[model samples]
Target: MIASTPRVTATHPSLPAVFLLGICALLNLYSPQPILPALAHWGGVTVGSAGLTISATTLGVALTAPLAGSLSDRLGRKRLIVWAITLMVACTLCCVLSTSFHQLLLWRFLQGLTIPFVFAVTLAYISEESSAGSRALVNSVYVAGTAFGGFLGRFVAGTTLEVVANWRYTFVALAVVELVVLCGTLFLLKKEANFTPSRSLLAGISGAWRHLGDMRLLLSFGVGFLLLFQQVGSFTYASIALLHAPYNLPPPAVGAVFLVFLLPVITTPLAGRINAARGPLFTYLLFSTAGAAGLAITLFGNVWCVLVGMALSCISIFAGQSASTGFISSHCQHDRSSAIGLYLSGYYLGGAAGAIVPARLYAHFGWPGCVVLLVALAAVSCVFACIAWRK
Candidate 1:
């Protein structure tokens, strides 16, 4: 009988700890989403301007992800992950004290810069620690935590916004929740048994750039960018659309829409199982179709259709991401961590663009216009996925 790898056995504690890390990272990053309309009201900004809260944070993430990935290689993934959560907890608390939108944006951008410490490392950690047999499932578990975090952050903020009278207090409450998650992570985060810190920053950057030359990996990065752009842009603009005009959803009601995220908690693991059975290429194509179909359905104005569409899209995002991550991890060798980091840079850059550009589209073109933009991006992602498949 063959023995299980030391890496897999050692990764046991890392699994749930990184799960908590995913939750914490997402909670800090997405807290502004449900409250954009409130920001517009309290900060005397337009909806498009208010959406910058999310854009600024994601832009920071885009800027820092590659650096964080390299540092994770040099500093150890666990160290960076722990430090990021500690600093992010403090930054999130400080966000509540901001007196103006500009101040708030500054804090959010700083908050974003810290996110790569956790996110960039967590993927590398999972890739390094888990056995190939278990990597997809573990990745899916982390993705599930992220899905729940995005939901909880929006839901809690929206629900709290209903009762708190002050928007800042909603963040205060989220900060406290994250603080608990932080302490839990500190207790549970395991040491990296496999990683070797890079010798220097120059070598690390050069190594990461080398992976960018691979066409298959490059297309994967493009797919990551477009998928996230569609996800973030559609959701960010949808918040504003649902809050105004025909729906006029109250803050809590707007938050309730994120309940769609719950579907991924189920679909993500299922996706891993399917990917195991069918191969990631098939899994990617299947879910990409599902996501595009979901976006298309949203073109309908009915609340039921929109809700169902959002649910389908949520399932697609998590499952598709799991497949993509698994595929990337499987494909890379010496440059695995750097490659993931580059993918994340594209992913969050798309997110930053998604947050801002979709809001502008919605402002000019309305909700249908927003759906059109998402559909077009999803189609582009499909094209990229096709190219990746051919290679």
Candidate 2:
């Protein structure tokens, strides 16, 4: 008789650890965004080129996600996560030492490479450790942490730049924050008691391949891609737009704009409840449409209107993200880490594209052009959610 993989009754996991996982994973991902315009000036490059700092990190995330998944499946979850965060601290400090723009980009990419180890592995950990009754709630909390972390990163980076008149100090501050999180992770994160490792590396690879063949998973992946594309693309260029035009905001004020991200910290947990009652498909479509409307409001040429729109956009995307990730965790029957990894690969690939494509559009056709493209992407996400998540 063939032996089956061991299963343990799910336990109530540490919600705080999961939250910290999200924060540490994302703390550095978009730190450069609020100061992209200043970076361009400092580097003697165009806005689009400076945007590469964001893109390079996301590209590394996209490329490394699947491998991180496979390794987590073979080795274990917390082991990879702890090691990855340690490496991330080193990379953040390396960014401080960078003498040129290219070197900064290289370190950013390396930093990106370590992130999936924390966030992706943590997702699999949640799926395995949490009971069905509380799974979505825990996941929502993690998303909320990410939203806050994203805001904190940009706020600190931009504020430090303004106060010190030096951008490099921002990296030092990020490294310190990362170190604190790393220590918290060591204390709070428990070893996986419910995990059943894949039999071998070959088995993990074959499992990932099988996941790609599922139409439901594919559609979900597509939705993830479009969602980040809209969020990252809009915010990236919006900072630049605010720097120009009638608004003429300084870098510190632009960072303050990310306070809108705090909206998601409140809305995402609420979204988890709505998703549980109404279903992920309904939740995804509802929020995606709202996001597109929010994008439209940005074109009104008023600073207050733009912030309102961006705030709505931020809330909608996190709600949508909560729904999508919850659906994947609930639906995937096996190889949960591999599935989440594939989903993240598409998700951050969208983020990478968002950082680059919107900048080019903004240069050639202005903010309105970027808005139109993002709105269309939102519409596309709604379509995929309808098809994939239909009950």
Candidate 3:
């Protein structure tokens, strides 16, 4: 059985830094999403091919997440996060220099390689540092920050591309925001007070391997995979669909549609309280069902209906993410960073497939087909939650 760790006093003041950590890590991940159509036009490729940009990055994240977790287990948390942020900023700047689609994918993949260092490490840090009572709240805040960052990145990229008519400038804008976030991280993020590094890198790897057999961890990893698969698939294709349809929204307006994310910014933090009150299994099942319903509403073909559906879907995703991460934080006793790394590897591997599979579905059967596939995935995720987390 896993032993529970004693909670430290929650550091309320550090919440802002934690929030910023979420933003900095995610600001670049999906920034290219809104401009996929524009990229296809510029690169003389199909939308599916252009989406390889997102796939490349997610693929990189999946491959590196476990290694990053192990490194954090051997290195210290804040040190790894700071170094990763610096490297991520450099990679974003390099994206601005890409003259070809393949070159852009290469830089994007490199950027993904650095993100798990910040994402997985901070999650482990929060799990270690916060008291059990406040852990859910802290995780919720971080998830909210990520939701906002995802919105901001898409908004800024789409609007900038619309205004400048140049996609490269969007990368420049993203790089600038990342620089500001880097400075805040350096100034505000606290050093780990509860970390106990592994005796060696090999030991850390061994711990990660053992996590694969833990049912709780494995189930959480499955939940994570389905969550991102639904999220990335829905939004990436929806953005492309809006570009050519009865809606005929411009890139800026589509970017504005991402304002749906702001709703989560306000609502996701409540997930902590909800998980605490209702339990993570209850929270996950409730939201997963709601997400499927929301996707069904999108088939109505009205723009307002689509926006409303998307909003519900987005909110469900953030809440489910909080619940899943909270489960890992509470259930896993040893090498929490490695556990989170494995979770992220599955999560982002789903993200990579989400980017590719939905585009192909859209190509052959259209938006309704994408919706059907995503809703089915949500249903499967709900079933897994029921089986894995049942009392």
Best by lDDT: 3
Cα-based TM-score, every candidate: 0.89, 0.90, 0.91
lDDT tens per residue, model 3, 296-349: 898898888889899999999999998888888778777889999999999988
Candidate that would win on TM-score: 3
Residue lDDT tens for model 2, 1-391: 2124342222343577777788887898888976788788888899779978987888889988888888888998888899999999999999888888899899999999999998788888887777666777788888888898988888788888878888888989898888888887788777777788899977877888999999999999998888888888888789879998789998768767878998998999888777877889888888888888988998999999899999989999999988998899888867788888999999988877787778777888988999999998888888888889887
Candidate lDDT values, in order: 0.79, 0.85, 0.86
Q: How accurate is candidate 3 locally (lDDT)?
A: 0.86
Looking at model 1, residue 24 earns an lDDT score of: 76
Which 10-residue span in candidate 3 carries the lowest summed lDDT?
A: 1-10
Model 1: residues >4 Å from true position, as ranges?
Answer: 1-5, 9-11, 37-47, 237-252, 356-373, 389-391
**What number of backbone clashes does candidate 1 have, counting pairs of residues 3 or more apart or in separate chains?**
0
By lDDT rank, best first, the candidates go 3, 2, 1
Clashes of each: 0, 0, 0
| Of candidates 3 and 1, the better by TM-score | 3
Candidate 1 per-residue lDDT, tens place, 1-391, comes to: 2223387532477577766777776886777666778899988999779978877888788888888877777777777787888888788888888989899999999998998787768888888878777788888888887888878787778777878867898888888878877787778766767676678877778879898889888989988888787788777677778888777888667767878888897788788888877877788879878887887787777777778888888798888788787778878766567788899899877776776777677778898888887878777877777777563
